[model samples]
Target: MADSGSEEIAVIGNTDLTPSESENNLKNTMVEKGTNLLKRMEINVAEAEKRTGKNAVNMQETYTVYLIETRPVDAASEGTNPVPDSLWRRYSEFELLRNYLLVAYPFVVVPPLPEKRAEFVWHKLTADNMDPDFVERRRVGLENFLLRVASHQVLSNDKIFYSFLTEENGWKETVFETGFQAKADSRLKALNATFRVKNPDKRFAEMKHYGDELQSVISQLLRVRARAADRLYGVYKVHGNYGRVFSEWSAIEKEMGDGLQSAGHHMDAYAASVDDILEEEEHYADQLKEYLFYADAVRAVCRKHELTQFELEMAAQDLTSKKQQREELATGTVRTFSLKGMTSKLFGQETPEQREAKLKMLETQIEEGEELVKERNTECDEYVKSAWVDIERFKEQKDHDLREALISYAIMQISMCKKGIQVWNNAKECFSKM
Candidate 1:
């Protein structure tokens, strides 16, 4: 007789189980098998842990699992084509198997579990062979996973998980930490080195305190310099004399130079201990540029104002002097002519026509002087008016420029404050994570 197991078997179609009953039976079988497997795995892990003095493994700790339910797009239409329920059921089974293998025999390095690999099988079943939505979802899931890993300190520190998650193959947290620390240490050392160079000749130096004071003084100086510039500019606009304005500017410049020199000398003397002198030097350089700009503006205003005032004053003085000389000349000529007439009358008798002629000539001379004086006065007034208008214009421009500079400075300060807060927040996070 033929072997019983080898005998051919055939089943005829019979109206026996409904589709829902068949699905329920499959689900029951899957639940039973999964429960059994889970029990066995737990027993094995417990035994291993007892022998090795390690904690028992748990499913949550060892594996990450995701479950998805898919429904047919046209499920509402009875006759419309729909995704077979078998495909979804098969996919679920595969996922369960994959998760089990990943947790139960993590070191085995086996090929992906066959039942859990239904996504690939599904792709083969489709004629168009594309699941764009599924692909997009998977991509998004992977990206999110990576972001979590990167942000998580524990997972990021784990060599195995970190290597698997990151694109830089074989990367380790320890190695990364070492490199970061080395860079930080090098930067610190460089800063310290700078201190040494700055303080080479000093002994028992208070570099930190000195540097702080230096910064404070420099800040005050900057403010003072700004105010000085404003005042100088104002004075120059009103005075309009290059010579006078420059003279004042020269004095201020000297004062600034002296202040800088004094600061430098102190820095040099304390160089053996001070570390941030170079920073101070850079600050001073910037302040110097601002100071110079202010000085130039003031000088421009002063020169213009002074020249206008000088012209006006000179014109007025010349007119006054001319008027006085004209009056004296007229009086002297009349007296001289009168004396001659008196002498002629007492000794050699003179005519009235001669006296009248002398008087007319004196009157003509006086009238010419008066006209010259009047013309000079008119010029003086015009010069004064032009000078005043220019002074006002210069004042307005100076004020506008100052206002713009102030606004820019304020904005910069606010930006810096915001950046400082952001940096502090990042540092706090880093510290907590570490």
Candidate 2:
């Protein structure tokens, strides 16, 4: 269970999926390799501690905070490594930093933070926020999240993130002073009020669809894994009963007593092994959850692209309308029906001076609209190019991570099965001796 008073925070969700040949070809022009700042700077969340704090209502409460440690790998002029810096921050602070990253780099697929509350968890893994196991898992997760962001070519460069790491005091103040949340709110309102894209990019559409599929598949996998783990736990625990029954029967037997006792001991050991197996399995499940959360980051990039496209279209439409107005002013003809045309017909033709003034106003407005349209077009192009580059990078990382996770999980399961077989085999030997 998460803390009862855990703050309800909003995070960016949306991810892009798939890569087309065209995008692959453009990768060379997008971002250069070896640009990640973390290539020189190392970041880690090494520890978690429970602390007492005042809640919103002023009552004393306990909360968990993590210690973030950062150090530069690059040697100084004297050839010595930089001294490490550490900061203690609560989980909400991580959320704040991630939220800012999402807003600041809308085109980039921001790496996801670990879950604040456990879902689809195994029966053996306690979801309690203060549980030693849960806290340890979250600590590793937070560290992974930082490493991901620090390794990003763009996100690693954020001054706010640097401040979050080094400037322990007033970091929250710095984040709020950026006014990013207000800007995000305004952007949300605009998106809500805007019309759907008239000409959505085929690639983005495909990516968005793929993101949806990825999330659904991962969610289902996690759910199934949790259920399977629970069943496995029950099976192992139930075998402990067999150990009890056999051990009691051993005392009542004559010649078979020794063999029965040995078999009972094997059963007891087999039953006890599940506690460690399931714990190990939870690590793999957490890996799966990371990608499941990653799906949202993918879609976020796609959503930003849509917004860029939408703005571009709106600007182009405005420019076109302005150009049409200029043409009507020059030629005294209305190609499209409008209120202005009706008003002009009702009031009759204006004086030459009035016409000249209107022409001048239209000309100025048309010039500005054309400029706006050009800027918007450039923005859209740049957003698409940059977005595709990050998406490609993310795809490679995702493939590698998922493959390793799945492979490790399979190996663990195989080891577990072999152990079970060995226990049974030994029990069989004991029976043969009898």
Candidate 3:
């Protein structure tokens, strides 16, 4: 399939399955990926700043700005045929956009930004926590937030949303100001008034069913990818250990090969033996180091697998949250607020009829969210399958090299032992004649 779901066969170190596990899983994912429109307003965020920058003589800041790319796309184009326009924005900018939507369309549940986290010791500049990879993943989550909002009916049509999507000016502060206004316009008022979800229970149930399917696929893929990543990490460590060991062993073997070579007959035999062992070991040592170098390639794939799972997991969580939000609107009690930020329950709740209307709008969002999930799942499947091919090829080559190296070393040892026995017998014969 050209555009397929992300999948990989991890049976070697993972769970046992039939021999044709890859084929079977692929077949199953193919079934899950029902025919759905796979394109719309394309949005992507990349080129995240993963390093710290100097501000004043003593101050430093993490430059977490990312390039937000967007363009109109169709099912045929699918975000690639035509290039996208890119602009740089900070995580704060994305947060601003989301908050604005939350206030502007209180009736419409806005897609959320990822949880904003700060670390005192391991901030954005740190390798383990806020490295380039972590920044990149956060950027992807923010992009998904934008894409979800853009697909909504009322949210997509908002002028503020349009500016956020395409505007390149100092729109952030202005958007922040506008959003805090909370001033309702005629159109927003009309949306709130006319919105109604008839038979809310039936539609919520329908969306819940499809939403569950998308969640299952995403979660399963994450679990499988996680297993694969840990395995790849183990592989990297193995190669590195072998690389270090053989690398040191090769040096010692070379020292013996050079120093053990003196000019007498018995010494010549010893020299020859040393040379045989050195040649065998050095060749395989270089092989080990070469594979250790290749381990980088494996590590990169593992990172990509991690990223795929993360992006899909974010998408899945968004859908599930959206479902819950819809359910709350459909049947749950109204959100109540208190004066002076104090706890005081004194208000009339949303009517049963009122909740149903909001549920209708929410149902539309959930349905759209499900479609996006499927499209994402297909792309993820494609990535997982491709990564699997690279991983399997690496394993095969490693296995072959290991087997060949062991055989060559064994033969060298046997030859050296046989020659040593002959030399010992000849020396005894000489001593007896004397």
Candidate 4:
């Protein structure tokens, strides 16, 4: 967060000027700017009032104010990291705050009154001005704003936030009344100051540095696990040639298992860190579910492509029986094993030519199974992509519906506000005429 220099209190609509026209001229200019800003805000408020068929004065209240300041710290030194120039330059805290207010105000202001037409202007005004926790309340509002932005995974992507302006039902009233608007405004001001001092490039660089390190650890672990699985698969496929494949399989398995275990441990720790920051328990659970889905998909591929337990067991039995038969022949005891019995052989060693042929046949079967697994994996990837697309589309539709509702509500509010303002204005006119 960044500071907007020092804070100075200016009268809401001061008109008096002393001897210095220069000072007065500047003051007048600022006043006009402030007035215009307020008028624009009032217009929005009026629109909300009209749409809701509620009087604006009935909802008006004094809001607490707070200020947040951001200053830069040396990146090379302790307790500081640099941010990217692009982010600092492009991101606007003010705009974000404004958006928050636009969404949250309506819900916070004006409780239901029994008589919809009843005038509660004085009561509302008095309550707003008299609240003792105004300043503290404002601080809480700022905290909420920060929490929402920092914790929002979708918005953190940056692309998503930039691409769409999400709308909500009766957003204007929800934002202002809830004090989300004020809080967001303050936080944005603070963020602006921080961006100016720290810059976005430095911040992004730090994030990338950490992200890469974490990803590397995860990658290493996955590779190790995959290697181990491959070694086990090779051993099962070797049939009677266990001695030939044993040494090779053992070495590969050792290397892969070590790496995989280490990487998995690191990933688990990082995930825990993420969980700590997320307040909503369900959010973390949802993320876990998604990760599990991906993991299961990967396992499904392996299962489809690799040799099954039944195939491995049969191969092993056939190899043992063939070795026994060869021993008997060497001892001049010819024991005939029928083709039917050979067909049930586990290691697939029957006749000399049949053994060779079976090996080739098994190889072809394995390849075909692997191809099917690959196709399934591709389908799974496509499904994941389609799911995300659907989610984005749903969000867009939700936003549209909310906007329509808000506009309708705002129109009603504005009509009511205009009527109130008109009555007040007319009273002033009548007073002047008198």
Candidate 5:
């Protein structure tokens, strides 16, 4: 979907997502300051190990943990450098960190983690978690996820991330103390209670729509790729059968027997090459899957923006209603029919002192409501600016990453075709000699 020249899917900031001049200037200043404050850290997930583990109940279980190595890139003053820090973390722990990030930084499009279990895999690819190839691919993906977070101007500076990288012991307890999961649950409940936004920004609406479209397109692509790979595998296996038939026929020949056997060998080699080629293709497919999962993160940001806008509108509406009530009280007239006015008419008009007291209470509430409105407005504005800045950065990264992935995939396909052609050409020469 992210074609090189097509701005439809790749370009997120050119439209209403573009910030105003003041916001743009503010974003630039904030980014510059953030860059200076955040240190560059090298993070890697170089290996994985499957280990037998004991559960809380003393039950035995098996699990895999990844080795994470991190070091401050700029720590060296001139020559001497500190030793790199290393830790082993379960995949579940990575989930914990990512969940915290999503909750803590709702405005940011947090990077998605690789799938814990494989799906839509072909025959050659196993769904088993402990498969060496699958584990290696996942390790690479986890590394990429860390690199993405480590490179972020905002995410890089998070103390929790540092703790996740270096603090092997009591990390979960530290994360629990932050109460992030409780906050996320509370937010989810609020969202579930009210799914409507009175006023939605057009930019975020477009972004949410883009997220859906991107997810859909990428998912369909992966499905097609899997199906194509299955077919390709079968084709290569059929050629292997053809090679066997050729060798068997050569056994009954005389002068051309040698040529036929050699041609059969060439076919066998060509057929065997598909295994490695398809294995390499899995790497490219993983890249596509990365963007496929990223679509969800984009929607999460949009949903957070909508929540902010909804709160702002609710606050402003409450302020307006309070002001209107104050005006009606002072004017001795009801702008709209109310139960309180009917009650006053049936019982008796309140004394001037009581009326004045009620007016003062209304005035106090009006002031507080006005302040709340202003605060919510400011919150909404800041969220929009910060979210847009990150979105702009994300769009650039997405474009570059997808472009490189597609280019590499194309090169791989071209090389596969050339190798196939060479194999057949060699077979053809053997036949010519015969």
Candidate 6:
């Protein structure tokens, strides 16, 4: 049971899951999925073009697509090791991957992907406006995203992962599911397996499950927060370009300054206000990351407890076997055993006295082993209890903090939006007067 003071800290159905560490080697056992992906595969955005349907009359009906080139660097199979192969994928395809990662690994902060703009008018206008420079920029962003996913611990090892990097016939034309429905079942299965304790036990199962849930929720929240930061950067970057475009137009800043001196400053101020909101959002994201850290701590402790129990069980079995062997030796049952059992005697016969001495020593060793296991188990249990106390306290504080932060962020974003509308209105008024 967790500490009473922090009893309110519950993951599922108000059950308090404590944060503790038992297996020091548990972390070492974690396979870095992302690293393995990077070592085995490389991704590059190759030839990009607009794909059209059977009808050639309407060229504008075509949508932009890119050839995703996958290079297998070091595969063991004869046919697997090869030159780079490629496949055509639309922006929507990449979008699916982003959504899949966000939905699946709720703990991971999926990188910001390029925004979609499939509008007819926008596409028409940007036909010539969308230069190779801009296309390359977006491609780089997409490539960076794949690299990030490749390095991610959970995302890298997913079954659907191969479909992403491989140009295998079926997957080459694979259509991705959209929204939360995309990869939901597979993600849940992965999450269940990912959170499972190696040494299974009932008491620790719920704790591990709840811990995983908390980690996932917290991670998703952080991903949202980071996305806000990404949005801010996007806004900030465009705002700079806006200023540049304004500078190159109609004596720009000076002409605009003639009408309202504060107009330019007001736009900057509004951006600043939005940026502040984004900053706050990013901070909340960071705070959620801390919660994930605590959740992981709980899992480590739970695993340690499980491993200790396993050790205890094995030791008990060993003790039982040793005692049985001692009884058999004392009763001369060894002499009546089969050929294999007496194979050692063929090499060197053991006298009755020698056999008795060996049995006594074996019994002493098993007794000592049992005692050691018992002591270790007691120590592990104590640690588990202690960890639960800390987790409960931590849950009370972090959960409260997270709630407060969410409220604060909502208020800030709302306030900023209102301020932005006012500033834009002011700018419009100032410009009309000019």
- Reference-based TM-score, model 1: 0.26
Candidate 3 per-residue C-alpha lDDT over 1-434 given as tens digits, one digit per residue, 9 for 90 to 100 = 12211222211211112347434433432212222121346677756765577855868886677787776666335534656777777776776776565444332324456435411111112334365444654665677567655544334545566677678796776575543544334323433453333222332234334434534553454345345434533543443444344345445555443222221234334434443343343343333333433443344344334444555666777899778777555545334442411322345455668667778878898999898788667655655554455344445555686578668756865875686577556544533443
Measured against the true structure, the TM-scores of the candidates, in listed sequence, are 0.26, 0.88, 0.34, 0.18, 0.89, 0.46
Candidate topping lDDT: 5
lDDT of 5 by residue, 1-434 (tens): 11112111112221123235224423322223335223456678979999997988999999999999877667765565887899999999999999987876677788899888886577777899889898999999999888887667666556678788888999899889867787788778766775678879999999999999999999998899999999999988888987898899899999999999999999898889888888899899899999999999999889888887888888888888888888888888888899988998999988999989999999899889988888778778777877887777789889999999999999998998898889889999989988
Return the clash pairs for model 3, or none: 4-378, 5-378, 5-381, 5-382, 6-380, 6-381, 6-382, 196-357, 197-357
Ranking by lDDT: 5, 2, 6, 3, 1, 4
Superposition error at 107 for model 4 (Å):
33
lDDT of 1 by residue, 1-434 (tens): 11111000000010122446324323322112112212211110000010112224532332222222223333534465554331111222333332322222111111122111112111112222123333323333333333332222112222333223222322334334323344334433533442212212121123223324544554566656445444533432333343233344445564344433333333233322212322222233343333333333233223323333343455555556555544544454323345554665578633466546655775675567567556544543443343234334434543564466557655654764464465445434533443
Model 5 stretches astray by more than 4 angstroms: 1-39, 56-58, 74-83
* Model 1 global lDDT (CA atoms, 0 to 1): 0.33
Error of 3 at 113 (Å): 2.8
lDDT of 4 at 259: 39
Q: On residues 132-190, what C-alpha lDDT tens digit does candidate 6 reach at each position?
A: 54465456556756765565443455545557666445542343432345345554454
Q: Tell me the whole-model lDDT of each prediction, alpha carbons only.
A: 0.33, 0.79, 0.49, 0.32, 0.80, 0.55
Off by over 4 Å in 1: 1-369
* Tens-digit lDDT string for candidate 4 (1-434): 11111111121111111236224323333212212222111100000011122235687443322333222223324555444112111013324443442222111100111111111121211224223322232233333333333222222122212211122234334334434455445534543442221212232234335435534554454344345434433432342243233334435565454433333333333334322222222222222222222232223212211212223334445555655544443343436766544554655535657656655665565556556455444433433333233234333433464456446545654664464455445434533432
* For every candidate, C-alpha RMSD to the true structure in Å: 45.0, 7.9, 19.9, 36.4, 6.4, 17.4
User: Superposing every Cα of model 3 onto the true structure, what RMSD results?
Assistant: 19.9
Per-residue lDDT of 370 in model 6 = 78
* Worst 10-residue lDDT window, candidate 5: 1-10
What is the C-alpha lDDT profile of model 2 across 1-434, one tens digit per residue?
A: 01111011111111121234224322322223435556666788889999998988999999999999887766544478766799899999999999877776677778888898888888777888788888888899999988887766666656677788888999999889866797678667865775699899999889988999999999999999999999999999888988998899999999999999999999998899888888788889889999898889888778778887888898888888888888888889999999999999999987889989988998898889889888777677767767777778788888889999999999999999999889889999999998
The reply for model 3, stretches above 4 Å from the true place, is 1-41, 50-60, 72-84, 107-109, 115-129, 177-434
Q: What's the residue-level lDDT of 185 in candidate 5?
A: 89
